[model samples]
Target chain A: MSSSSSGNVGIVIVSHSSKIAEGAADMVRQMVGNAVPLAWTGGDTDGGLGTNVAGILEAIEAAWSTAGVAILVDLGGAETNSEMAVEMLAEDRRARVVVCNAPVVEGAVIAATESSGGSSLAAVKRSAEEFYA
Target chain B: MHNVNASRAANAFAPLTASAVLVNAVGLHARPSVKLTQCAKGFAAKIEFALAPDGPWTDAKSPVKVMRVKAPQGATLHFRVAGPDGKAALAAVLALVHDGFGEA
Candidate 1:
């Protein structure tokens, strides 16, 4: 949320399980402190194990930054839903949000660390995606 | 004898280097790894870390790679640094490790 002032890229973690989403967020906070804007969303509208596009959209809004936002998803469903959420944003905003293909927890941690260092949105996404490479 | 001479020659051109024992309780876990990488990124010098004198070094500025090192407490972290500020970078990293990443 405060990332707008910092001008650092924001991050959103999406997972099927609420616990995993929150836990990954906790790890990112512990490592990166409050330097990077971060948010997480998981589970379905009914609080079941699933991905919700609306929740992901709200999280993107909560963690939005002019610098851009990087989203990390745990599975196929989460990735697809995150893409949908990005599409729902205005065309200008949609271009700045990216769903990275990397391990969720590790990617979030690395991405947050890079963002804390005043890295650009593209750099942040690259750092997160580097986990797979 | 030839091998020993070759090793000596290699050392003659070695980059700036330093080593410090990890004194923290948990070693290079998430928190310390993040701290280490952050510090390394602040300097322009290229830095690498290895658990042994001859090792598979990992990029010190990459948090994910540094975390993968997983150097345990009491493990000696050997660093190889290059660039104009190599000395300063090595000192800063050594200081961070010597301070136990503020965890000890």
Candidate 2:
């Protein structure tokens, strides 16, 4: 976790397939800005049926350095992958990382774009609450 | 068909807030439309969607109401739910749209 205060909101959405991940991420970028960083994993690139942790880790590092990081993942193995990522982070870094359960792929971007001036965690949480409640 | 214009219907709920994207390549056409309507049926919130004049506000739970709205591909719909769990319900609708009716 780099200590830079970019105040930039970063979101990474993981899916079993890169297409799904890219689609959701692109949809969000369309709503927000074209510069949102995305870390795509899984599918043929990783040659697996689930998300690739290495790719996700790289994304996390990028997001953390730019601003805070929010993660949205598809259910099932994707969820497990996100959880594992959170566990791997240091205590302080873990605080900056939020694994959102909202319709994530869609919700995270909506929340991130909508947040504007709040912490990345707040935006992701809002998206999750909206999805949950 | 059932007295949508009735005063009682007007009094049935209040305004709510939510966001959703149009799923289904055809976008708000058939089966999924019914699914959305069905999901909203049990709620008393007065759901309304906003897009363009072509896509006017409609009840979230009514198949007929949704059918009349004509939300198309990639259209983003903002909903106001003015009843119980209205916010939550609206979020769900947003998810459905974002998911492209789970087709994505």
Q: How do the residues A2-86 of candidate 1 rate in per-residue lDDT, one tens digit apiece?
A: 4333588999999999999999999998878898889999999999999999999999999999999999999889999999999
Candidate closest to the true structure, highest DockQ: 1
CAPRI docking class of candidate 2: incorrect
Error of 1 at A1 (Å): 18
- TM-score of model 1 (CA atoms): 0.86
Going through the candidates in order, the fraction of native interface contacts each one reproduces equals: 0.42, 0.00
Off by over 4 Å in 2: A1-5, A35-37, A44-46, A65-67, A116-120, B1-104
Q: For residues B2-93, write the lDDT of model 1, one tens digit per residue.
A: 12422343344447877899999999998999989878877777788899977667889888789878899999999987766878889999
**Which candidate's TM-score is highest?**
1
**Candidate 1 chain B, poorest ten consecutive residues by summed lDDT:** B1-10
Residue pairs in steric clash, candidate 1? Answer: none
lDDT of each: 0.88, 0.62
lDDT of 2 by residue, A1-133 (tens): 1222356557777788777877876666544443444454545344666776666776687666345677887878777877787778888787777777677554655444433323356744664445465
* Each candidate: chain B TM-score: 0.86, 0.71
lDDT of 2 by residue, B24-80 (tens): 688886445545654565455666676753334675654444655677887777776
By lDDT, who's the top model here? 1
